[model samples]
Target chain A: MTEAVLKVENLQTHFFTKAGVVKSVDDVSFEVGRGKIMGLVGESGSGKSVSGFSIMGLVDHPGRVVGGRILFHGRDLVGLPDEEMRKIRGRRIAMIFQDPMMTLNPVLRIDTQMIETIQAHEKVDRETARQRSRDALGQVGIPSPDERLMAYPHQFSGGMRQRVVIALALAVNPKLVIADEPTTALDVTIQAQILYQMQKLVAEQHMGLIWVTHDLSVVAGLADELCVMYAGRIVERGPVGRLIDAPIHPYTKGLIGSVPSRNPRGQPLTQIPGMAPTPIDLPAGCPFRPRCARASDICRTTPETAEHLPGRFARCFHPHLEDAA
Target chain B: MSVFILRRLMQSLVLLCVMTIIVFAGVYAIGNPIDILISPDATQAEYDRAVRALGLDLPLWQQYLVFLSKLVQGDLGKSFVFNEPALTLVFSRLPATLELAFAAMLLSIVIGIPLGLWAGLRPDSVAGRSIMAGSIFGFSLPNFWQGLMLIMVFSVFLQWLPAGGRGPTANFLGINSSLFTAEGWQHLLLPALNLALFKMSLVIRLTRAGVRETLLLDYVKFARAKGLSSRRVIFVHVFKNILIPLVTVIGLELGSVIAFAVVTETIFAWPGIGKLIIDSIFVLDRPVIVAYLIVIVLMFITINLIVDILYSVLDPRVRLADMKS
Candidate 1:
């Protein structure tokens, strides 16, 4: 793999709510090399989305990055000034949200939305910006880009809106993009089309992507690597094939087992034993220990992330080595 | 588009008819206009002649039929007090009322939106907190008392502006318009400010709430991710989202200011419709009351129709084609 475009090192993002400090993303670390697609798999509130937001510096008030370094191409972004951070955002690293319906400004024309995005980073004439915006819509497979550009967001169908949003993201030629479940709200056929377009776009642009989602099948098909998050920490990280076929962490295994096709018909679907823990007052050790069959006294103490195989890491005392064999 | 407008116009005509009926019946129920019109010292013969000439001798339904017939023929009847066409009386005062309304709205929008945006964006800042506290005062104070206090500060204490009455004026719409002259603005300033206070606060609160809420939406975060400056995010993205609600409230507020600015006009002795209507009500001049109310209804209908069109323009999702497709 080429030099990583983004390397998040022991990053900690906490939400200081009235209740307490919520460790939304605690010591989360990963690397996305150029042209690579990494999936961040987790249940809701497991901090996968927060991790994506942290990278973009899009975390709102009461939620802040508390510790760790986010090294983007060797520049530490953890404590960078807002103005400096603004330069890298959208220009170098862009994001796609979960809901396309809510992502575009409802009142603005599609052309206005796209043109402003391009002009936000670069000092260009409106016509030039508009032309580039038009080209981007075309690039994203939107038909008759001219008319669509003039239309408002609501004029488009659900799938078409998502495509426009993607076009908006790609308009500036960003080097990396953190897509937070971009295809989750789309129809099955639309999802496939979006995924195909995204895969093609990534390869064509040589851009790194971090696909944050809970659906194992989506990442399994699209991502080269996967990081499974549990209670604000990564439980397992490896190449997609290796992690799916031989999940070292019990949480990853449970997630994989919970997929309907993996479970036999005419029976209750495989289920995780407990709900995902709230970020505040998480367990001292592995957050998933209570739900694991292999939990032991040693599991009472926190386990460090360790390599179980070449390029495969898991934070567990009782790694499922036998599953691989 | 023309069909939509035609449908709206048809709906408005029905509304106007209903409004006229309600106002006419409601005003008739208030008291006998004849008692106020006739002198108590006059003999019985004089009283009967006055009542019959004015159509007070007829039943309420029959009088309304007479009014409807005259109204269709473009005659709104002459004011018994002013001895001018009641429609003309109301319309002459209209320019003055409109000038004051426009000034108040301009002040409301210009001050309210920016202050509200600041308060919402930096809610925890010292200035932001103070701005919010100030808005609370704006909401809490009685309009009459607030107007008096402003007079005390600017007129009585500071002696910065006039306490009452219209100043040097220029002709507009073939009537005296204070808006066209500089000294006219000085006289307008205090009254317009007094009138603007409540609406300004409302706009501030509404805009602040919108900014607070919209700042958290997925689109806002996505815009930041694209590396757009905070200014772009706030002004372009956040401002546009909030505008839909702002437009709605401002439209209603504009109608209220134009029609029911009795307190401010009375306090400053401004020559506007509010004073005219109040005098007509006191004298029980049915023609003037009915004409004034009809004009108010038309104004409200026009504003509401504009708001409907703006709704489609602002948010495409609410439009017919968007909803259908």
Candidate 2:
């Protein structure tokens, strides 16, 4: 197998609040190879976003990576100093946020921000930076890149702002881009366009990607590999096609089944009855034990990530595909 | 954009007219000018002659018209106390006040903003907490008291500097190297510190809040993930976001700095517009009072206009939104 560009091993990120410590990301492990796209899927509070944040070293005060090893190209990133981390952040690894407004500062012109972003990672003159910024905006399918760069964040519609944000992410041409629900705020139509652009860039640049979101449909359309998280831990890991065709964990099955189009027109859409349980007061055993349909006495104890097939992994007392035989 | 500017200008004119009416009414309500005109030694005939010569006997409408016309022609009349044109007195004193306000603002931003950023980025650290505590204390303490304390420590105890005044003597023109010659800076230190202390606490508190808010945004996280150094992330990505609102605060504070100079000047015995206005008020110099009021109001309006223009330049969205609004 090609060496992994990024490897997160047994990571646990906890939030220390007045009430208690919430295990936002607990013992989650995954890998993304060069130019590969990993789809991270889970409901809110499943720790997918937190895991991405941990890898980025963006966790702030009161929330910390208590135990974990974030290996970026074989180098441990967990304990790396902020000064060193900054050198890697925008240059080698980049991130796209959910809200495009966050990515584009409201006070700065589009061109100014994009040019500055380009020059930040490389030693370049204004003309070169401007050309690169224009090219980036063009790559993201922004029409009339020259005029648009002169405009402000408020001038653009929600979708356009998102596209501008995507353009900014592409400015430095980083090797890895972590997109945390980048299209969640965009309309469905705009979402499709952005997704297409993102996929095309990753393929063209051979950059590794971690796409975090709760929407499985988006993952199905975009990701090469899939990892399903519950509470703060990954419950299943496999090829995207295999996971979609035959998901092993009950939690993964429930999620896939819950999709509206997954069922017949006349039938009721599947729903995970209760809200996502709080990470602060997670139940004993598997984090999904409270909602798992196949839970038994054995499930009361925390289950470890166990390999069920040649390359697929699931954290369950009774693996579904194995039992199907 | 031009339309927006035109609208703001019209509004400013209307505001100025309204302010003029209020000032006129206040000046009239204070009492008749007979006491000064007709001293005990003067007879009724002499009093009448004095009143006629002063145009005091003219109808209120006529007096207002004359005053407005003179104002339109850039003639603010003569100062009763200074025996000079009101505009000349204001213009001369204006530089000293502007210098103090500019000095104070520069000191506040230079010292407070960095401290606030440090505090925000490391909320749990000793440096962060100490900065927060200092900010709170600075904001809470009365300006007068702080000015007194500074005077006591820097002037009385240390005897390293002059207690107050524009300079050792007001004979020097602008850019006197004597101030930079070591001895002159010593004279400026106390007044600058006094003005700065009053404004610094505010900048620190506001900056802390602004930084904290910016830190929460996804772009900051994205910046961090991209491996930008903490300084770059905080100053470049985060500072721009925080500084938008900060600029607004700075503009408003500048107006207050001019208005509040009365107290600061008194404490430091500095020769600025505030002291000039105070002395004019005590002497009941009508032309000086009216000229001072008009000058201060116009200063505020112009500064706000500049700030408004800056907003559009900084964030394209704002200019776009303003067009629609």
Candidate 3:
């Protein structure tokens, strides 16, 4: 892995609203290696999704990447011209949204959407693009691919629609895929099925996948490595097994503790004490300090993210590093 | 699909009956048309004979039955002023208005939607704000006033177009229409623009609002991430989604424009049905008036049916819902 599939270095995405500048993603950094499944774990407003958008150069107006180097297979994506950025999107990196129902244009047939995606990056004829679309559908395990291609988004059930969306993303054979909670809207069984298929796809294709989600459980089962975000920053990063078993950053600990399965069935679930700080009024130091029980006088400033142990990173003055032994 | 169409036609049939009843009652209450038709110095016998000949002497309900029965037999009555079949007169005038309505609609859709999309995409930009502000002027100005202003500017000042009247009409498929010739378009431009002003503003507002809301959706972000060019993203993804509302509004607007282009037609002295109806109303030409209204109702019914079909075409969800029921 001389060059990871995608590497985000010191990414800062800010929203300049009337209220003030909202640092939606502040000083976040991570990398997804070849065939690696990296979980970008965070609750709502934690910037996990924003980080994904930033990497794709899809940040809308009022919010922008002010600082960062999004090296996709070694080329810097930050401030890339629209033409160049578009060339990379879908061709080299694809994204899946939380809801499959909304992703495909409801008015268009499945073939039209997929064909358009293929033709957008490649100079293929309509029939060729359509064939690629059918192949993509088959790859995602869609039954009767030809018939499904002719169908519209609404014709597919929830899980089937998600599979179509995944097919759309994988159609281009991109080196990296950013999935923003693509399975969150499905039933448990369907979610598990999609996750398994996606994991299999990544391994077989040797392409990196960034799974952005708030569900630690889903990522715990899916991701090889994990980055825990709190208030627009990656507060901890490590292999999933070590990160979940011996979590460091306080927010990560609180998040892991709050999972319903982690707590005893008869007991009340662990709850984080405060709502996430609004990006506009983030504390001068650690944005999570107010909600952190481990906050001390020395934790009044931002701690640098660095490797505290081999291949382990955390931005905390007092990370639970006793497990490093 | 056939079942849906059958149900819609049944609904339209009931609506048509109700409309005819209301229109008949409303017109009957507008006072005696015979009074206006007869001269003040005409002999009593002459007046009675004239009334009897025109069938105005019949009771209102009896008159309606006569009218409805003749309608069922495909006779739409005769224009008292023109001494011709009411349906024939209307059909002759229809092409003028149809061409005008189509032109106006074309102008509104072609100009309105893209401007609205641009403004919505960059709400804070100078062009975006200016476009929004200009649409306020478009919708706020009175139709007659706008027609007068258009005539003043293009005809009076610029001398770029004709002041009033329909230009030379060429027969196309046995339908004499001025829209076939370039000189016809020059004569048409002012009146068409005037007729379209309000509708253009409405399309702009609705498109802007829809695009603004749809832009914030995860699907739009996903479309962008798929590396599609902004052109494809906005046109295919965003535009297709927003068109549901636009199609609904445009269908209703087209019907209204054709039915109510009275002010523009009058201002330009364009020989459309709007002008015909106005004159018919003044002379108390009951046959023509009734015929004109029926045509309008039919047009509205047809437009609405087309709208429903268009909805199914533009949004698969509508078609899916149709299937479920």
Candidate 4:
């Protein structure tokens, strides 16, 4: 197996708010190997984004990585000083946000932003940085890369802007990229294009990628592995194909079953009965128990992560068998 | 770009025309200037003669037409009291007022932005809270009262700076500046600081809010993930985003600073346009008053034009929108 570029162990990120402490990401763990993509699938407020933020050390005030180790290439990133982190961030571990505008400064030219991203880590001169920026834009399939570089974020369409942001992430040849719903806002056509470009880039560069999204459909074709989160914890994780074909956790089953394409046309769509529990005031034991159909008395006590099949893990009292379907 | 500017200039011209009419009508509606111009002991004949000489005897519409025609020819009429062309009197005082307004604006921006940026970064911190609390006081305090208080503290209590006046000035670039001399700066400092306090508070709050808002934006997070130094993230990515709103505020505030310096100038006995206007208002010096109003209206229009241009420069989105229109 390729070496893991990132290994997050028992990570816990909490927000200390006036109302209460929000356990946004509570004791979640995952690993991403070189040239592989890990899909972090969760609904909104499921802490998937927060987990990504914690690893990037970008969590703001009130929200902090309270526990866990973020191992980047075997080095613990948990308490790394900002100066050191600056050297490692963008240069080795880049992140793409849900909104391209979030990554693109509306006022700055695309070239300036991309070139500066390069110069920020490496001691490259303006000419070399500019050339690299142009190449990165071209790699992302932007036509007339030279002219596009001179344009600002606003000059490009939403899809093109996201492509620019993707280019910026890849500009420094990062070993790991954490993309938090980078293509969620785009239409299907643009989404496919960006996803294809991202997959191609990661494979070619042998870079590890963590693609966080709520849509399983998106991850199905893109990621090598899948981690399904409920509330703040990972419920099920396995190789993407196996997890989709036979989900062990009830929540995972519910999620996969609910996909519109999974059901026959003219049939009622499947949905989990209850709402996902709020993170701030969560019930003890399993978070998905309220919404889970197979929940039992054993679920009232927190389920331990148990390997049910080869290299597949699920936190559940009753794991689904491979032949259950 | 030139087309955009031309379009905006045309709009400004229309706005200026409308503003001049309102101001002309508004001033005339307040009361007759002839009441103050004519001495209490003067006979009816003397009053008639004075009214005729000042063209106050003409109908309001005719008076406006005559005034407009003269204005078109670069004639601002004569000051009833100063016995010189009203434009000359206003222009003579323009240097002093411009000096004060510029100094105050410079002081506000230089001190306010950094403090605001600091306070904004950690708004809940001890220093940030204190700065915010101070800003509230700055915002709430009356300019006249604040000017007096500053004089009492820095000039009377400390005796470190002068109490009032423009003090000694040195000529550079054909403009006399108090900043060139120690005594002039001392004299200028109290009023400039007084003038700046309210605006400084505004800038602080704006910057704090802007920083807070921009920090929450995804781009800032992406920048951090890119492993750019926190300084670069805050300064380059975050600062540029916040500056859009800041520029708008600064441009608008410049006009207000010039218009509202009356109180500070009065307290400090600074011989700026505000002081001149106040004096003109008291004695009903119609020509000077009218000229000052017209000039202020022109200044506002010009400032607004600059701001619009700056908006395009700072944000390419604005430029694109302009191009579309």
Candidate 5:
């Protein structure tokens, strides 16, 4: 088996708001192997984004990683100094954000920003860095990258901006790239193209990817493994095919059933009852108990950890597949 | 790009005209046209002659047209008390004010940004909080009070520098007064430091806020997740976004650097344009006041233009289809 390029072990992140502490990412763990894609699928406020932030060491004031081990290529990253982390970032690992503007420097031309991003990691002259930047831009399917590089971020369409951001992430050919819903802001057509480009780059470069998004369809097509998060905890995990085809957790089942394409035409869609539990005031035992259709009296008192399958893990008092026949 | 500039220029001209009208109305409201030029004991003929000489007998519209034409010819009329051309007086002192404004702005950015970056990168730590508190104090304290405190410390007690004035009287223009000579720079140090301190606090606090906000952006997290160093996360990903909003404040504040210098110059007896304006206001020097008004307006318009151009250059979304083939 290939070695894992990124491993997040027993991570916990909390937000100390004025009201109370919100356990945004509670005791979650996952790994992405070399050249593989790991999908973190959850709804808004489910802490999927928080988990990504924890891994990146980007948690801000009032929100912090209280406990965790972020292992990138077998090195601990939790308390690493910022200067050292900077060297590793963009060189060995790269990230693309959901908003292209966030990833870009608005006052800089595309070429200038991209070239600077590349040179930040590598010791290359201007011409060499420029060439790499051009190649990366073209690889992401930007037309006439040379000319486009002279333009600023405001000149590009949403799709094109995302493409530029993707190109920047790939410029250094890093071993790992974390994409936080990179195409969420784009139109469907553009989203498809970006996804295809990202997949192609991951394959061609043999790099690991963590694709964080709520869209199950995108994850289904792109990810090798899937981790379903609910209320800051991993509710279910498995191979993408197995998880979607035969989901174990009730939440996962509801999520899959609720997808419009999965239901019959004009039929009432299946949705998990109840709202997502607030991280600040989560119920005892399993976080999903309030909404879990299969939940029993025992689910209210004691949390259950799924017996790890050979290659998958889920947390539940009563996983469905074992009794599904 | 050209269109953007032209649009801004037209807007600036209209704004300037409106500002000039406001100034004229303010001046007209203070005293009757005849009263401004003739004594109470003067005969009716004397009053009439003075009114006609000043074009005060014309209709308001005609008066405005003459004012506009005179302005176009670079004549702002004579001072009511000093009897000097306003344009000449304003022009003569323009360089000194520009120097002060430039000096203050440079000081603010040079000291504020790095300090704020350091404070933000470690918000929870003692050193970070201390710096933040100091910056807050700097921002909150009145500029005049800060200037006085500096005078007490550096001039009265320490006696390390002169109390006030542009430079030593000896060889005042003998290459020593131009910031080139050691003595000239020494003389400038106190005023520059005072200006820097006053504005530095504001920019620092602002930068801290900007950095803190940018820290949570998904792109910054993505960069961190890529195992990029904290400096890169802060400088490249975080700082870039932080700087965009900060630039607006910085540009606007550049005008204030001159405005605020009035107090600082008065305290130190520095020969900057702010002091000149104050002197003109006391003597009711119309030409000097008008010229000062025009210069101030021009400064603000130009700074805003630079900011807009900068935004378009840095952000691709600002430009339309111009960059695309």
Candidate 6:
């Protein structure tokens, strides 16, 4: 296997609010190898997006990475000076946003943004940056890249704008890309196209990608590995196929079971009972305990992440066996 | 683009006609200027002669027609008080007002934007809070009072600057400028600073709010993720986005600044249109008063039109093509 391009260990990002400290990302660990994709899956408040932000060092005020080391090619990014981090950013690592408009300056031309992104990291001439920007747009399958480059974000449809955003992210050809639900706002057809393009680009460029999403179905086909988060913790993680085939954690099973496609067309979906606990005021021990069907007295204590199978790790007192599936 | 401008111009023309009627009617309604022009003790023949010379003997409608005809021919009527063409008087004082307005605008943009950026960037910090507090004071204080206070502190107290009046003037490119000499600048500084104080605070608040809102946007986070330096992210990505709204506010505020300068100019005795208008108001110089109001209204329309064009330039979303229903 290629050396891990990005490795996050025991990451904890907390929001220090007036009421209480919210552990947005707590002890979440994951690794994305070169030329591979890792899907960080969770519900809205599951800290998946926060984890991505922590990795990018983009967490704003009140929320901070209090613990954990983010390793990029064995270099610890946690305490790296802002200057050094900036150098690594855009140049070595990039991120895509859920809303393409969010990733675009509404006032600026697409070409100007892309070229500036290039020029921000590298001292390239205007023509070279412009050429690269044009090429990037074309790579994202934008028809008539030259014309599209001059157009503003509002001029394009949602899908095309997202394509432009993707083009911008890949413009620098960074080693790792942390995409926080980049396709969530896009239509299914466009989402699929973007995913396909991203996967293809990742493979062709030998880059690593961490695609954060709540929808398992979207990443199921694209991500090589899966990390399912509950509240702020990674509850289960393994190869995508293995985790999908026989999810050890009951929460993972519940998530998989709730998928509309997995249920019979006429039947009501099997939703996991109860909502995900708020990060600020979480129930002690297991965050999923209140909702877990297989939860027991042992769940009263925080479940330490342990290897439940040869290659699968799950943070659960009662691990479901392969035969149980 | 031309179509948009032409349409806007036509609308402005209509607005100008309506405004002219209103101004003409309103000025006539405010008691006859002839009463102030000629004393009550004056003989009937003398009064008749004054009235005839001033064209005040004509009916309101006929007087309006005469005024409009002269207006179309680039004559703003003769100032009853100054014994000069109203347009010439306004034009002569226009440079001073423009100079003061531009200087104040420059001060506001230079000082307010950066202060607001800093405050917005770290809103919870001590310095940020202090800046915000200062802006609140800036917004609340009356301009005349502030001007008086500045004069007291910087002029009367310190004796470092002049208290009032345009000290000396020099011709720059055929336009009389009070900013060319040291003594003239000293005279101009207090009024300009006083004028800028209110606008500066407004801009600071605007900038702070804009920056705060913009910081939360997706593109800003994406820019940071791309590993762009904090400087680049804030200045290039965030600043450019915030500039759209800032420019709009600044453009609109400029018209108000000129209008509000009446108070600042009065207190400082600056030889600007604002001061001239006040003097005209006291003596019931109807032509000058009417001309000033008309000029200000025209200025507002021109400024609005310019802002609309700038809006399209800054943000392609507001382009003429997109503006079509």
Task: Name the candidate that leads on lDDT.
Answer: 1
Clashes of each: 3, 17, 1, 5, 25, 6
lDDT of 3 by residue, A121-240 (tens): 889899999998898888888899998888878889999999999999999899999999988999999999999999999999999999999899999989999999988999999999
Question: Which of the two, 1 or 6, has more lDDT?
Answer: 1
Q: What TM-score does each of the candidates earn?
A: 0.94, 0.88, 0.92, 0.93, 0.79, 0.94
Q: Model 2, which residues run further than 4 Å from truth?
A: A1-3, A71-75, A81-84, A109-136, A144-157, A160-175, A205-207, A322-325, B1-10, B36-38, B69-84, B168-186, B320-325
| Local lDDT at B300 for model 4 | 86
| Candidates 2 and 3, the one with greater DockQ | 3
- Give lDDT tens digits, candidate 3, residues B59-130: 989998998899899998888888899999998898888989999999999999989988898898999999
Candidate 1 lDDT, B120-149, residue by residue in tens: 988899988998899898888998898889
Clashing pairs in 1: A89-B227, A90-B226, A90-B227
Off by over 4 Å in 5: A1-23, A27-31, A57-88, A300-313, A321-325, B1-106, B118-154, B168-198, B225-229, B232-325
Find the candidate with the highest DockQ and give its number. Answer: 4
Q: Could you give candidate 4's per-residue lDDT for residues B40-93 as a string of tens digits?
A: 899999999988999989998898889889989999889888789999999888
Proportion of native contacts kept per candidate = 0.89, 0.74, 0.89, 0.89, 0.56, 0.88
Error of 1 at B159 (Å): 2.5
The predicted structure with the larger lDDT, 4 or 5, is 4
Please identify model 6 stretches exceeding 4 Å from their true place.
A322-325, B321-325
Q: What C-alpha lDDT, on a 0 to 100 scale, does residue A302 get in candidate 3?
A: 83
Please report, as a residue range, the 10-residue window in candidate 4 chain A with the lowest summed lDDT. A316-325
Q: What's candidate 2's DockQ score? A: 0.49
DockQ of 6: 0.72
True contacts kept of 2: 0.74
RMSD of each: 2.6, 3.5, 2.7, 2.6, 5.0, 2.3
Those runs of model 3 whose alpha carbons end farther than 4 Å from true positions after fitting are A1-3, A265-271, B181-183, B320-325
The models' CA-based lDDT, in order, is: 0.89, 0.81, 0.87, 0.88, 0.79, 0.87
